[model samples]
Target: MVRRARPVLSSLGPVTLDRTGVEPLHRQLYRALRQAVIEGRLRPGERLPPTRALADEWGLSRNTVVTAYDTLLAEGYITGKVGAGSFVASALPDAPPQGGPGRGDARRGVGLSRRGVALAAVGGDMRDPSGRPFALGTPDLNAFPFAVWAQLLARSWRVAGRGLAVDPDPLGHPPLRAAIAGYLRAVRAVRCEADQVVIVSGAQQGLSLVAQLLLDPGDSVWVENPGWPGNRAALLGAGARLVPVPLDHEGIDVEEGVRRGGDARLALVTPSHQFPLGVTMSLRRRLQLLDWAAARDAWIVEDDYDSEFRYAGPPLAALQGLDGAGRVLYVGSFSKALFPALRLGYVVVPPDLVGAVRAARRHFDGGTSIVPQAALHRFMADGHFAAHLRAMRALYADKRAGFLRTLDRCFAGLGRAEAGEAGLHALVHLPEDRPDRTLSALAKRVGLTVPALSDYYTASERRAAGEEPVGNGLMLGFAAHEAEALDRAARELADLAAAMA
Candidate 1:
């Protein structure tokens, strides 16, 4: 393993850099040295400390010390002669600009790049305050088998050998891929081979990778009106014009989506269970979407997030299973099942796209780390994964029941809970007059965050023309907390609704 070199920072210098701070240590040291030189604190012609000496004195890496000195030399702030140490340059290159771009107040803050600006404008703002009770879109982390996981992780690392040294397969760890392929076949009834599964950091990364691989600029993409925010943001970032397809009781309206997005090249759908408003896609609807994608030469990115924890009804096969033409790209994540921090996800593509996706992954994502992949493989191989899933399903079933009951007791008829028999969250529809955005903010003030359903609707003009009112609801998550905590959160939501009403 390559360990980061330590820094040898001292209080004696004009500037002290925090090792843990987000700013790079080299950048911080460079700024400090530059400022000190410009202010004449370090006299002209004075020799700076040797890189070795400074590194030893401040517990910093010699390279960090050298880089800082090198930057100063390159910028004319310092000079060096062969066999002589570096010294502050007697004559500087140019005077600091008095009034240039980002002068005065602008200079006080760091500016973001164009890409950074765009991402920030549409980024998610999730908070896990107050021990993360009822936190949406997160698994029940407290129930994870950390001890068993640690054992598996240690074993994988010890036996790593070549895996630790060699460049990883961009597709994934082989055994882990095999494990996932087996699980998908036996459990989800998805048709895939181990070689076709491409492991990723998470479904979010998988979504972005799929877009990068397939989408073109200005290409139309069909998205659910009130859909997964991550997918919507990613599609927008990929330069796809998002046409919001409204949802019906069966799932995303396939006919409506195609009617609106006739020229669309891609579609993102959560078919097993719709997000926010939980509803399984009917077979006819699935087939219709499949037909549309196959006929139009478009790709369907099937996000089967949290498909393992079904609490009621018959099991539903993955949309990819029924996809005969290989148009569906199935994506899933361990974030919702295992834990968010695990950051493990997989994408099962068609046989034809496997090599293309795998070859592209080396250049783009470069696959996920091998350690976690190996550990997860062992976790599944040992039957711990299945056992964990069973326990979590029961736990969430109770949490969901308790949550709905509390809502019934506290604020009956005020909000409607829309949830399928599975998944981590449920959507509570608020009255039309209520600003779901404001209600979400009010809930967050007390450390309980419920996402506003309206924020998921991107097509303003289309929604206005629709017969049904624009989506106004609270996307409540019940899987993360215990019964007591869920009840408390429900009471809080009720109180907020009453007060706001």
Candidate 2:
């Protein structure tokens, strides 16, 4: 074979080219030169050696060097003189000198608003990670047919084409919305057309959207006392003052909410299965709430979270379905069913408010991913979702039974299973004196997750009055874990509680 041409030596800054690298030779050269210029390693207006000479030095073709030089010139990294070699552009790219904030301008960490600071405080740390056994609010992800979901997702890309790839409707994918409407009608008795359902990232986003549209700054919004932290934060972020109403066994005490904030513009209540406490709103209570809302010209935000896997009697009818006055804005999430990462949920709004809700969604989040929406449409159409829910209900029922049995075996007093063993978690009552915080901390130390019920309440002092929060209890999750695993963990938790006692 003929010997390779010897490289002509040229004076330039160090640029060791790796021939074995996956990056193109021209790109590597371009990057090296760019870095040198940006870092000021190459002084401004410094002339570069002829490409022909540099090419030989780097063991690359003359064309490769020419391409790099051309790119640099085109991108303003360097200038080319017809008769002369490439020169580093006089004005180079570099940050302002380090000193004051603007002098070293960073994109972030600069003059954050009060809202930003408040949001920043909202939590990065999780109470339990690695899907801690008996953790509340977590679904049994193993039960979800992820492989089937993946196939459907891939199929959506192939079949749906460019539309699926582009920015979808801020409201939602029409097909998915239609499917959701039908599902709601058949199962939850929530009557609504496809247009009435605005797809959101989750229940949280749905709540936020409602808050943004309906709630003005300083507007009052009633929420459950021992309610979800996300709901509280979302309302607070929207500048809505919370009216923390006490909950009875009949769910949110409407009279108490009225007494606290009767003039409140909005009421965010979880009627089907109250969070932390797990009380289903009585029919009378539901009517009372509806009447109160209608009388005050106030809106009710019905968060129907975790009504799917109810181990008790038939699933309770959604407040939205029963609503004759169109006062309730119904919210539900798939996090408890499919998985939290999916981040797909919907808010069924009345006909009048749909446009405003959709507009708010556009400003908040342009739209949810079309691929998942399409996949969900397919999942619902194929009966896989229903089948999965059926299987999970049975599985969760057994797990709930195991947890209750553990409570009976290991603990003294009777611990009531909320809504007669509905949802993913159960409420185990502790003595009034046993500080729930101490119990929660002690449980956490043993690698067990038992969320204190009283912690859900927001007040100056510890306790809530009038059978509210129903007092000291542990909100133990039972659905995420398998029956045997839950049994072991619950027993171990009981042992920890006993030892502490």
- Flag clash pairs in model 2: none
Off by over 4 Å in 2: 1-127, 413-419, 461-470
lDDT of each: 0.77, 0.76
Model 2: per-residue Cα lDDT over 20-117, one tens digit each:
66657788778777767767777788888888777766667999998788666644567665678778878752222111223222443567554444
Worst 10 residues of 2 by lDDT: 94-103
lDDT of 2 at 45: 84
What C-alpha lDDT, on a 0 to 100 scale, does residue 400 get in candidate 1?
A: 78
TM-score of each: 0.75, 0.74
> Which run of 10 residues does model 1 get worst, by summed lDDT?
95-104
Candidate 1 wrong stretches, greater than 4 Å: 1-118, 126-130, 464-468
